[model samples]
Target chain A: MTKKIFPSWIAVDWGTSNLRLWAMDDTANILGSAESPLGMNAIAGDPKLSFEAVLIDLIEDWLGAAPAKLPVVICGMAGAKQGWLEAPYCDVPARPSDLAKGAVTPNVTDPRISVFILPGLCQRADPDVMRGEETQLVGFMAQNPDFAGWVCLPGTHSKWAHVSTGMIRGFRTYMSGEVFALLFQHSILRHSVDDTWDDASFADAVRKASEQPTAFLHSLFGVRAGALVAPVGASVAPGASVLSGTVIGAEIADVLGLLQPGENIALIGAGKLASLYQAALAVHGYRAALQDGAAITLSGLRQAHDTLISPPQET
Target chain B: MTKKIFPSWIAVDWGTSNLRLWAMDDTANILGSAESPLGMNAIAGDPKLSFEAVLIDLIEDWLGAAPAKLPVVICGMAGAKQGWLEAPYCDVPARPSDLAKGAVTPNVTDPRISVFILPGLCQRADPDVMRGEETQLVGFMAQNPDFAGWVCLPGTHSKWAHVSTGMIRGFRTYMSGEVFALLFQHSILRHSVDDTWDDASFADAVRKASEQPTAFLHSLFGVRAGALVAPVGASVAPGASVLSGTVIGAEIADVLGLLQPGENIALIGAGKLASLYQAALAVHGYRAALQDGAAITLSGLRQAHDTLISPPQET
Candidate 1:
């Protein structure tokens, strides 16, 4: 008798504005990857039908002749109230096991396709919450068994989590990125700097922010005057840098002040944003280790899938 | 010999999105105030012509006279690069004396009119800047001779100023109000709350924010989830309050942390926004006194006009 082997399940991290998909073997090695702009927000109503069409089309393009009955697990904003299938929120101090055991409704369109949706985690005492990053945090925990302390996932809305004993003890979020975009794009100071950061301006802002953190907002208005009144020349990069640094630096100071000295800081995100956070942390005397969010999500999805396929004894 | 006295001077605060005109008597008491949707931005080109037309139309109805000419001092974004005439910027720690000594250009269409367009202020070391608020700040300084420390002007783009020894030494702008609007009107959290904040929700948010200042963004996400997962009869006020509190509280915390302990904080602006800033400051152990924005602007404009008309001090 020949035994049949289904390689492994797929992992998906779909958010409000973007989508990321990965195909991994049983060992969680990613064999292929795909991305699209069809975020949940773009396909909220009638998502079941729309998502199926897009998913099927993408899968056919990627796997070619591969069948459509493969098992898959998804996380992030794609499972929110407005997502493809409203995956209800899971309460926090949530763990990998908790997320793995969380409830999920079947995809209405495809009964043959077994899909597991991860729920966002929320705190009971405070108004704090996390959707997609919790899954990535679980993946990070799976990779580093003894990891503890804070993990900051920076993006449009950055999340800072306090993890201990393999559970997300607590977390906070900062609208640093959004604030930066609005100020730079929509506010009066937009003309202060031409869309890029000047090294001198950036350095000065960082230093000033660190020193006179209270004067942050007050200092922001200086950008416009510096450009128009003082005739700072065409190089508004310094001004832009200072604006960016002050906000980010203020966030760092707020976060660091909340944490004790020598607390471990892990940064999980991608590209320039992650680097900026890393640099800001370093400026404030914190050593933040980097982690790729995509990798962590894949690992986390696999760990969650394993928990479901192999049910362990509950304590 | 008869000394001439201008019957009325038109005080205009022309911003990007709204135009406010005040008919002021010799003493600068606003005899009548009028607002129109015809802002500087609405007039794509020939701002002087467009502005003159709008002002003439609005005033003709009130004054019952043919509107050929009127002495006016315009401030705010109308004096921007895209404004009627770029009023050029002034160096920071700007003072009434500096504004008094600032330059003015006559209207291109009506050269007989001496229009004093107020200049924005900029900081030498940072990218921060401000425009119309300089006039308002000057007005505040005129009223309170001993006023020093931080003056927070709340608006779409909130400004925090360091006023010492009658000089606007430094300031910073926070996009807090604008962020609140964008998040509630445009971002993912828009659907979480109703248009207004109820008592419970507002108080709860303010309290939570004061306690856990860092968890602001995380708390914001809870607004949506709370509405979804909570009891059907659950009040949406808490969710909205949480959102409001998080942004406002975080801003207050950032500003307070930026300033020295026990420094005097003055809340300057008009209406509900100023009151909100005052409330936020009170929450953070600072009693912020309120100053009327319009009154300040008028005083500042009067001072500026007086200075311009006075003879220059010889070296």
Candidate 2:
């Protein structure tokens, strides 16, 4: 019979709601991948055994019967305190490569797999924390070694990081996305907002909110009040765009103070939210170069894995 | 038996969530009062019949056997388009007396009562509307006729009106109260906030948010983040006061621009919320005189009632 070859390791992006795994070879190329909704939050009845069972259930085929111990690298909320095993945060003003140094290996009964959970980052003075995004940041830096300015990773909890000389200086998080969702779905404005999008209404709201940032509190109610008094044409709602614009505009106006005049901005992530951020930035005359978050996350995980295999001094 | 005495007219303050009735003398004194949870929003089936049923259920005894048709002066959401009858809005830059002119009398099945639903005020230029609060505004002005600055009525949807020379020149509304409740109980910050009260934290947050209003978005997340990495001493949650402070402070900062350097401010309402607004203003070196919103609502209903009893021109 012809000899068979197997993948070298596995990479996992385990967050609160989803689990994604990638099989990689010695060349760091993806050989195969698998995904499941069983994230860190889904583990029950003895976390260690549950996690091991879930992992084995998904990738048991790749493990083969009595195969050599495979290195499984993990990132995101799986390293949280309430997660499988805590990999404490690496403080700010540190290199992304520092993630591996703080990573922790959890004991596994399955002889074929060895798991390593990567550490997140934390800023003590300002009190901010990030899990999976740190890996993405490292990947971005790995691609553009000379990049120095602001990197915005937009999501449910949007993060804005300041980077220079291969070090993450500091960062701030905004709950704008979460707030928008809450207000749109739960607040009194719910009666006046829906999935509608109007570019003109959005642009006007962006400008007005930027001009008078303090007016945000007052203007928020205007979305409902405006729709009540003079709704858009035939539709009952005129606020869907205005609500989104005001939120994004308020975020931009606040973060503007952190940027230098004409500073370089790289926006990471994909889909409609990222596009909205890009459009919002353009509203302020700023052009942001977009980057793919998935690719960067993989690159960052590989960087950590490489570090784990060979210490910098030994290499 | 001596001739039994009864109220000449019944004053009603039927809002979105509650229906309040007061047996008033000709001088606007409340003799007997009754209230029910069935406000305009609670009416089911035929609106006219449902509303009449709810009103008669609560105040039927007041309308004794063989009573004459008593004037029932009603205010608030009862006049909303979706309520008993659509009483259109009275345009702003109007006198308190204007509410009665725009009032529409809804036909009632009961011959013992003559119903008049007072109209709410609307600002056509800026597109703002108020149902019950407009009555409270008129009441505030009635108590302090010389007061000509800003009237801050804080509630679920807070209203700020600019009054000068016995006319409401303009006004704005903020959803600060609603936003606070949502964030405190529904958002991610819910995990880090509760009913805990910390005056120092509240005041400090007020000062910071006031000085940097644009930072409100970023600072909001900081409340959750701050709790995570560095929680308050011995408490898992340290954000209750900060959340309230940030919301109220942002409102104060935004409305500050609308006021002159030494403008007078009258805050209408009761309980902890009103106190918080008062404290937030003091952080900016402004003192807001507190007024009882319940008393003011009654006074406003009386004003509208007086208007209905005797047409200003006819009187």
Candidate 3:
């Protein structure tokens, strides 16, 4: 824990497996921050008893001696039906900035705080739902307020939202990350792959799969056959890379197919996942500009707070 | 265990998860049949001890004091490199009748039995392999003596063999079945699908996949999102059907791409799997003649026996 400072308001990003919060001044700059593995999976029983108690405890020191109650805007899985509040989804052909239109305020027993959960977005025609990515979409909208391009947020459920002017024309979701993780970690293919990856093989595989997407299943089987001749207990980087490329490439092909001739792609994610998407996108002739995930998450939360529930001035 | 019977020859289909055996008279007519959970996975330590002992024990009653040693033909995973005996794969672009060219005789302690493990087939260019399916291919050839078309053997690892004039020109292996099993049984998609399948949805999904072959990840995620509103505890038949169709359709598309003009398709499998494939194949303007799997396996083994190991006096 770092030295605590008094803050005007708070922004929370609560997902299935992790929780992150930032204390901010009236000007929207982060004053202090904290995080925990306690997320939706950690919540138990009633929100008033379990959710509020844990949340209050986490921000207890930061709340020290501040007489006025602080306002909080939250995003992510915390708004899921199983989360703290069921903030119903706003169906697409809609903008992420309008997510607040479907927001729901959770009842918190703690008089020191007020919480509003931002709703996620959904696509009815295809039947897809995203929780926290809505905020990132907002954050993306905030960063490029007048931008007209494709904003891709890659993750377990990677999302690609088409933005023109200020509204989302349409968006599609791909479980590419989920496919890779599931195949690598739990499938029979697990025996033939490892954490290692090869860039050249990955790029080559991307092209192969995108060209002949029907060959997906065979390429996966190839990993199993390829692993046999590898050195005993050796790294399966080459195989893993090929499999990863195949999965991502198929995804890129699908999303890119939905793109207009020269629609630019702007990526709103961070770290290795973002880099992988960048490399994958580059192979397809689209250079995606990386948008820092943390920055956008905070920015999105700040935007939500400012628009929906600005803090009251203190004495 | 039925009444003990003395048989002139025996056939064994030993796979990774289960084992099936048949006792046959000199006329290639079945005398008795049996099955057990003991399979290739059951083999432990030295094959001479664990494999042969369990196998002999399984058929000790059938052995019944016959003067001449009984000849036994074996197929499937039991002949894998890691099986009871290392029966090397016969390289292909060759006829299934020539599979015996790569057969290996496993040394057995029981003088009552002379055991031969059937060799599987392998492809050099693509580096793909199959053990039991080769026997099925042999079975297929037995039924359609002069067939020149495609023989699809769908299962855990689905195989499509391009057959023309008594030989397999080339074939490809797809892990679509494995993908569905791994995803439905072990991955996060488990909660979102079930055993029940909807024909309409399945057929529609098959068409969609065969046409696009790229929007696969979205459809998988659709299963998850769709599960939320499904009837209480009701099986996700519709979703499961869609997924199964997608996987199988992709496979069909890949194999069909290899076809020259308008060729026929023969499906060699049994029961539900065969019917499901039948419906999927029908969607793509091809009506596959379904061959009984058990019969083909037996007939193929019988042909192998008659050609390579049958007694001289067969009147």
Candidate 4:
């Protein structure tokens, strides 16, 4: 009996501040996972260096006894302008196939390693763009073929995309995480509350922001004075929560306001961030579905790899 | 004629992070001025030491030559809950006379000094409050008795107040300055530009933010990605300008949106901050009247001090 040897595929999602890698079987089940701090930002100036070196350091034990040659598909800021190699931006209303068909540049120093780089997605309507989330969205769609409407991936630059019939129609980004961090760390409000968001305060802020949406800008400044003048009573958590909730509520309101009524919304990503978006959407009277970000990215990378191996038959 | 000697009033605006002193005649013209880094924050927890030592060190020569019993009216965060003394907060919609009527406590160890600490102003709306700016606003109103409108004092926590019928009707705070610093210093957008604001970018971001106001949240995240992906194209001048303009523009849009149509706005501050507020207001189709912050604070302090010395006649 002849032993059947299956090809092992690797998926990598590298961003500005962090790097994540996944090892999967031919069927795309996760065999192992590895991550590192060696993000694209860590080695921006030098593009010729192998990102694989960092990856190998993180997961050499996982690949124990495996052959040196392995096929890997990479996405995100790793292919950005200052990333390991420039993959360029794919203009808007982009597709999964657009990413699959994008260029692949082998590491100049290592021929055994084939690196398929993914292109970023951009739109002209609002000049909105994304470098890696599109692949995750594709992966998300592959798992739930019937899923449609809006998919929101919350993060430093949170993305809200319109997905229908397997195509990413359009999307927008919100700097919620960065704004929250700025207010909490650098603003006078930093003196109030503990590190984490207080639930009661957050809920109160969400309610206030939703009710008086127009006062978001005016309310943000209160964070500082509230702390200075009334520290004991004025918890930074509520003030920050209010500032964050107002800005985010305003953004969600603006985005949803533009959409036609009855447009479904799906919340992606993980933990507090995704919950915040989900809560914001709910506050606005929208029923949004939730998706696991890790699952979406893994599925998306596998689908892209499969499509590349065997081109889909045209309808 | 018996030579009349006017009581020398030593005005000190002491706060957590700064200390400013003014030697004034009975008429309130400045004779000599001094400032130092010995703000309240610089000496918060130490009880054994006093700001008096730092004050005397900075102005020993002037103090020795001037009256031995000069009275000082202190304002700002110097009298906050954690300040040298806790002066407490006065409820908002406060009048110049009301501010003057606020309480002060003499220094425990210094019998030669009569320190009248100014109280902060608090509002029921969002329970927002402020301290030093109220005194400054009082000074502003004292300087321009006929002026009435929305007075915006831009800083770490920008304050926007409605001044009508000689009273501050309502006020709001916006974390514009802190947001600007965070985006410039810590975020990925730092490399996109210098501190200079380009007219074109400022106008463009303001216009964009005004039209799609929610974009402010998303555009903030762009600061990071912009630095990483398109650092070369992100015009440093325009980028910084846009970052500031976007926050200010969003603020204006929210504040204006809350107001009844055709409401006038006035900006009170100095230098770049004042100009930014002025330009932001203009983008929203409102021409702001400018007021000097220093002049206002000085005038307000004088008015408050005068009221403390004189009782109002019953009307």
Candidate 5:
């Protein structure tokens, strides 16, 4: 017989295109988990009703009828101005665990649910902001308290953070991932590029882009022009790989310039993207350790939950 | 009564999306002109039949019944592999007038027309090619035979040609225009950007991009982040302007590095794009002269016609 378990609280990661949930017991162990495609960008009607309806539909089993209110901690774009509630950005260098300090609570008519949205992190000097990645940073620091160096989270908008002693020093976001998607799917390069692996071509492109970053636009055009004129003797097409290398290489070069000779570097992601970044980093003569992104995010949300349940002593 | 006039020759500029025709008199003056939306790309059927049909449809009035074969000099995508005829690329550093040397003739049963599609210019070393722009270069050279320096053709695929002694020394293409369009219309930045001019904001962004060219993708993300965290108090939105400045500045920075301090630069296009390039150049402490694109193209076609009618004696 399956045992009926009720969660003490819930964790939500609502981003632009996805809404993920984790039901956790008091001990911070996940009892159950759920996900939905109803991301922030998909909600066009009432934000409050829509978000509540989606949340309730996904976790109805966890919410006992007319039971005492269960706290729900949320992160990501769900805290933006256009989200369920606007959670102001906390400027760095600030502790990732302190995300709850600037968090905003949203009003809910459902007696079973109480929602608290975590604030994102921003760099006032450089005009940069992160909605969901800050929580991941919090989770990462919790796992590696003594860690002091760079943490890269590669995705649609790849983010790199400088952390020290549990505080996020500063961060920068690169649109390379989104740029690559747009160029491959929409730009003139679409005609020439195809899914194919060419390690030599990719490495050569990476080296070229890293060495002469300024000539990036010129090099981008070469992707299409090269296919038209040169047509490399590869069994599979190399344009796609070359394009990927060029983009990732430029990002690496920019970040590499900011860093000194030796520094601890870790990538907070998994799968092909993480491997690609690791390969790209190798191209730049740097080694980076990999971390589970989902785990780090959960750890971050748990930190926020702990803060909510046990507010710091009046000091 | 309307006077009927017949042309001595015809000049055609058939690009990927549009087909243009210019009926020229014996003195190289335009007698009448026609245009059609059936460009090279629109013709999916047999190239010979489609091209001939489209040509007859647009210039039927110019073609009299049982008339002598009229010479037609064509340029641009009409000479591409998928075009009406494949006019092989002539390698640079080649004189623009020498385009006709590699021209391909397409057989026609129209009885009233004879066609010669001019070849494009390609740089084998750099792997760059220009179709319609080469014809414009030829025309520009015909007008200013003594001119030598840099010629900038700003468009979807901006081309910068280094010219000296009536030959295209080399050329480079930048897809900044297409990239700007793709980003503004499809990228996440679309939510933040709008069409409003802010000269100061634009200039500032241009300066930043020009200074740190490698940090382009990072700076691109800044457009959205800046709007989100720190909304500027300008009467109109500055995100769009900032985006434009950032893209154009990067291009100028890349090109500026290749050019000398005193090299004469002329932009070979009119209206907003040319003006924008001129404004962007001014930000880098340089001035550029603008030329009418259409006039230059007509002149180039005239030169090709002259070459066809009166072949230079072999030395």
Candidate 6:
């Protein structure tokens, strides 16, 4: 027989518009990786291709002719109501380890794959839900089994969750980034703002937002007014700064009262997005510790995989 | 020669996208009226068609062939820097009667028309400006003359101006309506919302936004989350309602602190938009007196016409 080098398992993180897969070895080190634009929404209209076909297309090169089935751990919107499989939400207060119990195995025709979709977390009282993020939270818990703090997964829809002793107590989602994108890309504010803005301008905006938070409704118009009356002064790079700062500032101000007492904040995201949050948090006197978003995602999938595919550890 | 039935004066209210004309008799009574799509933005591209050509196209039928120069009093963005004539803004607190003093006249080829573009209102301290609404304020002043209260002119850009005695003291603009349109028409909220929500749903959303006003950051997502989780109950018709209520609620909360110490609000606008503001205000514990937006607009234009075109009365 040919020398066998098939990896142990596959990890999938599928969202609305994008999909990513990592082939991991038995020890959970990534052996290979692939990504596709075929997200859940893509499969919705592709009557010609099954979700399995799409998934396999992305990772088919990584799979040999071996008959062994790879245990694929999937998370995010791929498990949404409209996704390939309906993985019902794991209602809060949900424990990180117990997340695997709610996992749903969507029957796939491919004998080459055994897929386990992890359930997202939902809070019925406040009527809040989070997908993909709960996996990151589980990853964080796997790394720090006893840390009690706040975990912020900032993106298009930024999520701030409360964690204490491996349980996600509560969480809130802010549409700050989405609002910023809509305004910057499509609204009148786009006319004035540019790419280059000063840090000072951003800080001023954040301060303005935090100090007189209610003035936000009025401030939204200020961008347009400023652009019209004093283009050089109001715009000229500062316009974008103000828009971004104002959005983040309002978000921080709203969530400020809800943050747990103490200074522990684990900002688990990579790249410039996480850095901006760190900077914004510093303005409010909260020093958030940064962690890699992708790293934690991998950790989470590994945790779920171990909990599911591996035999229960001796009690 | 045919007996001249042409009005002695013509009133023009030209905005960015639309133009309105009223052929007022010497006594300032409307003899005929016409409107067109030849707004400031429309004539921006056609060098062959001067703004005069477009205006003449709309009002030529009303103008008699007589050699007498008809004084055309105009207001709105037609006076903007980018408009037909750059009618500079009069500084606040600006008297309604003084708007014409700052009027700029564009040289005319047609001797039958003498156009005077009235200046808009501008505040230096806060850097705010209004072009068309000042005319509406002047109109409101023409009716009451001594009415001292808040005049809210709601539209795409809703303006809440403070008028005391005969001056437009100070004002602020809220982008609540614009933001709502963007989110409802362009954002994800549109998919879930219908046009069937009741008063109670709106009231609940308004109350939620007003009470824990800071929770607005969280509430925006509640609309999307609610749509996904409890679409049957919370969104549906309630989606649009909640979006509007949340926006209006936040506006009230922010502007609430800035409202002058009084109970009287002159709700100046037309139709359903005005009524909604009335309901929103009631939620915030204020009963606003309603007035017609167009009626005031015409009244103000007439006031401007009388102040500028009519013979100065010896007081």
The top-ranked prediction according to TM-score is: 2
Q: Which ten residues in a row have the lowest lDDT in candidate 4 chain A?
A: A1-10
Model 1's CAPRI class is acceptable
Which candidate ranks first by lDDT, i.e. highest?
A: 5
Residue B164 displacement (Å), model 4: 0.5
Q: Model 5 reaches what TM-score against the true structure? A: 0.88
Measured against the native two-chain assembly using Cα atoms, what DockQ does each of the candidate structures obtain, in the order listed?
0.28, 0.64, 0.47, 0.40, 0.63, 0.49
Which of the two candidates, 3 or 5, achieves a greater DockQ against the reference? 5
How big is the RMSD of model 6?
Answer: 3.7
Best by DockQ: 2
**What is the lDDT for B149 in model 6?**
71
Each model's chain A TM-score: 0.86, 0.91, 0.88, 0.83, 0.91, 0.90
Candidates 1 and 5, the one with greater TM-score: 5
Q: Please give, for residues A70-180, the per-residue lDDT of candidate 5 as tens digits.
A: 999999999987888889899998885568788888887777899999999988677799999999999998898998778899998999999887789999999999999
Worst 10 residues of 1 chain B by lDDT: B61-70
Instruction: Please report how far candidate 6 places residue B10 from its true position, in Å.
Output: 2.7
Per-residue error at A87 for model 3, in Å? Answer: 1.8
lDDT of 4 by residue, A1-315 (tens): 533333376788888888888877876677778787778878674666457677656555544345665667888888887777788777667667877888466464444456788888876546567888988888877876676677888887778888877788888787667767776776666665344555566665666665665555665655545554555754345555656676577667657756765567777777877888888787767767777887888788888787776679755
Per-residue lDDT for B29-128 in model 6, tens only?
A: 7787878887888888677767898888877777887787888888999899888888878888888767867888899998888888999887755557
What's the true lDDT of residue A132 in model 2? Answer: 92
lDDT of 4 at B152: 80
Model 2, which residues run further than 4 Å from truth? A1-5, A44-48, A56-70, A108-114, A231-238, A311-315, B1-3, B44-70, B108-114, B124-126, B231-237, B311-315
lDDT of 4 at B165: 72
Winner on lDDT (2 vs 3): 2
Candidate 2 vs 5: which has more TM-score: 2
Every candidate's lDDT: 0.71, 0.83, 0.80, 0.72, 0.85, 0.80
